[model samples]
Target chain A: MNRIFKQDVDNILKDMYVTSEMKSKIKEKAYSQNNKRIISFSKVAVCVAAIFAFSACVIGATSIFEKVKEKLGNTYETGILKAIPPKENTIYNNISIDTAAAMTDGNSAVAYIVIDDKETVKRIDDTAKISKLNINLVEGNNSMGYTVESVGYDKNKDTVIMKISIDGKNLENKEISLEATDIMSGLESKSYDTKGYKISDIINENATFIEADKGAYNTEEGTIEEYKMLKPDEINIPINNDKTIYISNCAIKDGKLYVQYKYKAEIPNQGSLYFRFNSGLDDYYNMPNVVRNFSVSEKGDICTDDIESKNGWCYIENIFYIDNISQSKDEFLNTTIFTEYDYYKNVVRGNWNISFKVEKLKDVFEGKCNIDINGVNITRYSLSPIGITLRGYSENENVSMYDIDPVVIINGKKIHIYGTSSSEWILDEYKNMEENIVFKYSFSNVTNISNAEKIILGDKEIIVEKN
Target chain B: MGVNIVQQEYENYEIHLDELMDKYGNSILRLCYMYLNDYNLAEDAVQDTFINVYRSMHTFRNECNEKTWITKIAINVCKSYMRKSWFKRIFTTDTLKEEGYNYNFNTNIDRENIVGEIMKLPQKYKEVILLYYYYELKIPEISQVLGIPSGTASIRLKRGRERLKETLEDWYYE
Candidate 1:
C-alpha cells in the first residue's frame, strides 16, 4: 500500500528511538523556563535559498547540524550559489569544473563542477549517499591524500559542488586538476557518534576510538630527556577550603611532566590546564601548542600493552622514540613549569608555582569489573583515575548490536563513558576470525569506582563483580 | 527506594513527559523533518515543541486537539528556526573550496518514500499535504492548525493533489 508517502519511510519514522533518557531530558528542560531561541526566517531570506541549494547536502550530518536546520528553509541550489558568487567558472568534457578560484581554506578544497543539475538533484532524492566524483588533488609531481567531504548541487547553474579535504598538515596548493572520470557514488560509512548513542552505549561496539593528532610529539634532541623525580615533600600550597591537589608522585621524563596527586574536594571539579613548555628558549614564544599529544594515567594504566602514543605523552613502560632527550642542564632548569587547577566560576585560577615542587602524582589505582553481556564475556578490564577500559572476545569476526550500551550503573544512576584507546575495531561481518577487543573510555566526575553495580548493554546486564 | 516529596512531584512531570513523547513524539519529529529537511534540526525543533507544550500545559484548555496543538507548535518552532542568517554564511559558495567538513542533507527515505516525494513538492504544497494526509486531519482541523480558513485549506488540498498527480501520475494511475 504505497500512498503519496511510502510505507517504509513511515516505518522508519515510527522506529526513531524515543529514549527514556530523552524523556527525562524533556521533563527537566520543560520545567525549567530558559529557552533562548534562533534567528528568524525573514531577516535571512538568503538562507532559504541556501536551504534549497543545500537540500542534497542535508542528508549528511543531519544529527549533528539539527540545531541550525531552520535556516535550511524552502529553496533551490541556484539561489544559493549565485548568493556566494563563484570564481573561475571552468568546464570539463560534459562535466564542467565551474569554479575553483572562488574558495580557499588551508584544510579543505571546494570545486563547483557543472553537470546536469536536474538529474543530480533528482538523483539526490533517489540515492542514500552522494556519489563521490573521481577527482584528485595532485601536487607538481605527487598525488595528495584527500576525500570528497561534501557534494551539493546548484539547479540554476547545473553544477555539482564538490568539497574535499586534503590529508596531512599542509593545504597550500594553487592550481590543481579536477579529474572527472566517472560519476563516482555510493560509499556508505557507519558513523560511531556518541551524541546519537544513549548514555548506556559507552560500551557499544559502535564505540569506536576517536583518532586525533597526539599533538607536536617529536623526539627531543638529546640522549636522555630531562627526567626528574620529585621526592615526597610538603611544599607550601595556597590552600583553598574547597580544593587541594596534594602531590604524591612527581616526575619529568621523556618530554612529559607527570604529576600524580590526590585531589580532595568539597565540590566536584572539571577543569583543564593552559601551560607553556619552557624549552630553554630566550623568551616565551608560542610553540605549536601540542597538548593533545600529552596523555595521562592518573590512576591505573591508561596505556595498555598496545605500544602506542597515549596515556599522557609516553607510556610509563617504554617511552622511547625518535632521537634521545639527553638534555643540557640549561634545558632542564628552564623547564620550571606552571599549572593551575581552577574550579567552577566562583574561584579564580590558582596558578600554583607547581615548580614549588611539593605536590605528588596520585597513586596508580586499578579496578576490574567482570560481567557477562548477552552471554559474551565482556570485561570492564581496568578502571583508572583517567577512565575505564572494556574488553571482550569474539569467536566470530564480529559481535552483534549487543555492544552499544556503554553505561556503568551505580546505585541505579547511569555513568556515561567519555572516549577510549586500544585496538577496538568496528563489528563488521566476518566468519572464523577472532580478536580481543579493548575499549578504554573516559568520563567526568568519576573519582572512585568502588560503588559500580553493573554495566548495562541493552537488556543484558553484566553484574560488575570486582576482582 | 524511598522517594522524597519533591522527587514525587518531579515524577509527575516525568510521567507526563514520557506519555507525551510516546504519544506524538514520532509524528512531530516526522513533521518537523519534513518541514526543515534536516534530521538533527527536526529533532531539536521537536524538543523545543515539547518544552513549549510543558510550558503551556495549563494553557491547553482542551479546545483544540492535543496532537493538532502540538503539531502547530512544531511548525511554528521550525519556522522560527528557519529565520537565522548563519546557514548561508557557513555553507557559502566558498565552502566548495574546503574539504573534510561536510553534512549530507538527504532523507533516509528517498523519493520512493511518501515523505520523500512530499518533500520534493514546492513549499506551498507541503503544509497542506502533511496535515491533510500524514496527520490525518479533516480539512477544518487542518485549517485550524494552519490558522487559515477551511476554504483555503480545501483549495490548497486540491492544488496540492493536482501537483502531486502531475509528479506522481504513474503511481496515481496505478
Candidate 2:
C-alpha cells in the first residue's frame, strides 16, 4: 500500500520542476539582500570596518551611554565632546528607534540615532535605509540642511546606526522632531554585457536608426552637457529588455558614440543605467569622458497612481567622444552597461517618530576673516571640536570651492581638512558662477580647535580671530 | 578590497543555492504538493523554502544530515503557510482535485485512490505518512522535520497507514 501511495505521489510530482524564471528571481533577491551593505564597501573600506566594529559594540551595549559613546567614536573617550542623553525605547511596527547621542557647539549639531528591529527573524537587512524622512523644529521656522548617514548594521542585534548632522541656526534650546515613514532595503547593481555583438554589425544588419533627441555632443567645443531637439526622422536607436532599466538605444555619428538608456522613474523600484566603453588597454579610468543629457518632457506628464504607466519612462543618454570609432569598434562592442537598481525587498511601514531637545556646548569658535588667496576670498569660518565650516567664494569662474583645501595649523602642526559639504555655486544663465561658491569643511577627527593659531586657506594663511 | 571578498562570497552562495535547488527542488515541490494539497501553493512553498534556506544558510550547523536539515526547513515553511487564515478560507478539496487533475497523472485507479485517501487523513498523520512513504524518510528524520518525538512519528505513521487501508479496504486487503 505504501509502495502504491509513493508511486502515485511521485507520478503527480514528476512533472513539477522549479522554472528558470523562478530561480532567477530567487537568485536576484538573495544577491540584493546580501550585497546591499557592500554598495559603499569599495569607496570606504576602512569606514565599513569601523561601522562593523561599532555595531559589534552596540550588540553588547546595556546602557544608552555606552551606545552613545560608540557612535560618537573615541572623541567621547578623550573628553572633547559631551554626549546628550537621548529619549529611548520608542517602539513601532516591531522596530525600536532611539536617539543615541547628540552634541552641538551652537553653530553645528550632530545626532546619532539607532534603529533596532525586535524580531526573531530580522527585516533590517544590510541595505536597509530610511525613506520619506522629515526633520524639523517643533516650534520655530525650521530651515535646516541635514545629512543623514547610515553608519552600519549589526546582523546579530538587528540594529542600524544613523548619524544626522545639521547646521545649527536657532537650533539650541528647541525641540527637534524626526519622522521616517518607510525603511527601504535590498539595492542591487546589475550589469548587462553585450559581448560578441559588434555595434556596427548590429546597426548594419538591422539598418534601423533614429536621430537622438538628446545627448548629442560637439567634440570641438568640448561641451558635453548640451541639449538638442531631435530633427525629423532622427537616428535614435532603441534597445528593449525585461528589466527596469536597459540600454534603449545606441549609434555612432560625428566621431561620437551615443548610448541612450530608458529608465522607469517615480516607481517603487527605481533604477538608472550607464554605459562605459574602454579601449581594453587600461581600466575604464583611462576612457574618454562621457557627455550626457536627458529629454525634457513635452507634455510635462507626471506619474499616475498606476505603477505600470508609460508616463514614467525617462530617457537619459551618454555620449562618448571616441577618437575614431571605426578603429575602436571592438572596444565599443566590449562596453558594459551597468544598471544601478534600488529596490525595497522588505519595507517596514510605521511612524518611526522621535523628538528631542537640542543641547548646546560652550566650547565653540565662531569668527569672520578677510583673507584672499589665488583670487579666492575667505570671508567667515567656524571651528568646533567636532567639525569646521568655512564660507568663501571666487569670482574667477574657474575656481570652485572644491579647489580650496584648507589646512588648519593647530599647536604648531598643520592638519589637512576634508570637505564634508558645500553650497551650490551661484551660477548665472550661462552656467558660470555669478557669486561666491560657499563651502563647509568637516574633519573626521575631533580636533582641539581652541589651541589653533591660524587656518591656511588656499595658499594664504589668516590668523584665527574671535568674533 | 572588501568588495572582492563580498563578491567571492556572493558567488559561492549562488553556487551553493544552485546546487541545493538542483538536488532538492523537485523533491521539495513534491513534498509541499502532498502537504498543501494544491499545486500552486506547493510551488510557492518550494520558492519560499529555498529562499529561507538561502537566507539562513549561516545558521545551519551540520548537526544532522544536510538533507534532513533542508527537509526540516521546507516542512516548517509549509506549516507556516498552512497557518495563514487565508490558507484555510481559500483552500478546498474541489480546488485540489481540479489543480491535481491538471498535472495529468496517468496512474492505476487503485494507486490513485490510495494517494487520495492518504491525503484525506488528518494533518498530524498525513505529514508523517507522506514523509515516510513518499519522501522515504526514516522515523527519526521525520521526527526532526515534524518537530515530534520518534515514538509519535511512528504512531502517526502506523495509524495513517491503517486509516488509508480502511478507506481503500478492497485494494489494501487484496
Candidate 3:
C-alpha cells in the first residue's frame, strides 16, 4: 500500500517540475539578492551568542535584532540599517526601556524598543505584552501614526522587543517617543465543564431584563439590534476561587447566551478575564459541524490608565448567538466554558519613555498612479529600501484592494510582495470615499530600486520610472 | 566570517549554483506545489526558499542532512505565504484552471481521487502526510521540517492516515 501510494504521489506530481526557465528565474533572483549584500556572520557572533544563550531553544544563533527585522519583513543583511544607542536606558519600577536600534529609507521608519524586567521579582514569559502603549514619531507639528507590535520575548533577559513602525510618511531627523504604563503577562486559560447543569439552574428570579447596551448581534436581521437581554445579578454557582475572578452572571435571551466575567482589580490591573465555549474535541481534525457566532464586550475599565487604580474591578461579557437555541441548548450544556485570564505575573506599573532619532539609509521612490484594480482605485505609492507602501481609494467595502499579487520587478527579476504587516483603510467622510487605503508590503530580501524595472498590480503593469 | 570569505567558501566547496539547483530544485518545487496549491505562489516560494538557503549557507550546521534543512526552509516560506490574507483572497481552486498549471490531474481516476483527498485534508495533517509519504522523510526529519517533536510527528502521521482511511473508502494502509 505504501509503495502504491508513493507511486500514486509521484504520478500525481509528475507534471509539476522545475523547468529551465523557473530554475533560471529562481537563480537570477537569489543570486542578484546575494550580490547586493555581502554575507558576514562573524561580526555579530559574540553579541548574537550572548542573546542566543537566552533564546537558544527557540532560535539558534540568530540575533534578536535579526529576529525583529524578520518579524517586520526587513531582513536585509546589510549595514544600511544603522543602530543608534539610546540617550539613556531609562529604568522605572524595576523595569527598563531602551531604544535598541532604528532605521528608515526616507519613506517610513521602524524602531526596535526593548522592555526588560530583569531585576523585577515578577516572571516574564512568552505571553508578556506591553498594553496601553502610545507611540509618537513627532517632528514639529507632524506626528506620524505608528503601531507597536511585539516581535518576541527573550526569556533569558526577561525582556520583550517590540517593533514600532511609523508608516505613510517620511520619518527622518525626528524623535519618536514610546510610552507605556503596564506590561501584562502570563495569559492562561481555564475550562469549566457544564455536564449536568441546565439553563434554568443558573438564571433565577434576580435575573433582570435590561436593554442590550453592549449591543447584541441579531442573526435574523444580520445587524446589531436592541434586544431585551436577561442579565442575572448572581450566577449562584459555587466557584472555588471567587475572589480573584469569576463569572458574575449569565442568561439566555433571543436565542443567544450572555455570560459576564468579573476580575478583582490589582495594583497593576492584575486579571482581565474572557469566556469561550470549547468544542471539547481535538483541534482542526475533530472540528464539529456546528458553527456558532459569538461577540465579546468589556466594561468598567479603560486601557488609557494602564496601571492607575480604577474605581471598580474589570467586567468582560461574552455574548454568544447560539443557532437553534431551543434544540441545541442541551448540546451547548455539554460544552465547556473556557475562561482565559492572565495571572498577576510580571506586570510593572510605570511610564518608561524613550525618544530617539531615526537615520535614513537610502533615498526612496515616491510617485502617483491613476490605476483601477477591480473597482478599487490605486492612487499613490512609495517604495522604500525596506518595503513598499501603496495608498489608494476604494468606494466598495466588499471589494478587497489586494485582488492580485503585487510583484516588484528589479532589472527583470520579479520579487513578490510576500506579506503585509499593516494595511489601514481610513474612511473619508468628506469625500464619501476611502482615499487612504494604505498597503505596506515588505520584502523578505533586500530590495534596491536603483535599477528597478516595474511593478505589476493585477493585470496592469506600471513602469517604475514613468510613474 | 566576512561575506568575502563566504564568496571564497562558495568557490572552494564547488557549490556551483547550477549543480545545487539541479539537485534540489525539482524536489523543492514539488514540495512547495503540494504545500501551496497555487502554482504561482509555489514558484515564488521556491525562489524565496533558495534565497534563504543562499543567505544562510554559512550557518548550515550539519545537525541534519542538507535535504532536511533545505526542506525546512521551503516549508517556512510556504507558511509565510499562507499567512497572508491576500493568499486566500486572491488564490482559490479556480486559480489552478485560470493559471493553467494542470493542478487537477486528468490522467488517472483513482490516483486523482487519492491525491485530491490528501490535498483536501487540513494543513496540519496534509503537511505530515506529504513529508512522510511523498518526500520519504523520516519521522525526525518531518519533525525538524515542521518544528514539532518526533512523537507529535508520529501521532499526526497516524491520525492523518486514519483520516485518509475514513475519507477514502477503498484505500488501504498498513
DockQ of each: 0.07, 0.09, 0.11
Q: Which of 1 and 3 is the better model by lDDT?
A: 3
lDDT (10s digit) by residue, model 2, range A1-467: 55765676677444556656456555765666544432111111123433544444534675655655655555566576766666646788889888877767665677777788889876886667675567777787464556566665667878777777665554676778777766766555443344423455434323234434344444323353434322211233333334545455556656666555555554332444444333332112111244343433446432212223245555544555544222355555664432323334456777777877777655567677777654566677777766666556676443433334567887899876533434434445335442354455555434557677887765667777644
Colliding pairs, model 3: none
| Total colliding residue pairs, candidate 2 | 9
Residue B21 lDDT (model 1)? 82
Q: In model 2 chain A, which range of ten residues has the least summed lDDT?
A: A38-47
TM-score of 3: 0.47
Candidate 1 residue runs with Cα over 4 Å from true position: A1-9, A33-413, A416-467, B1-16, B87-107, B149-152, B166-174
Clashes of each: 68, 9, 0
lDDT, candidate 3, equals 0.57
Q: Over the stretch A62-133, how does candidate 1's per-residue lDDT look in tens digits?
A: 221121222222211112211122333333333333332212222223232333323333322111122222
Chain B TM-score for all candidates, comma-separated: 0.79, 0.78, 0.77
> Cα lDDT of model 1 overall?
0.40
Could you tell me every candidate's TM-score relative to the true structure?
0.37, 0.44, 0.47
Question: By the DockQ metric, which is better: model 1 or model 2?
Answer: 2
lDDT of 1 at A70: 23
| Candidate closer to the true structure by DockQ (higher is better), 2 or 3 | 3
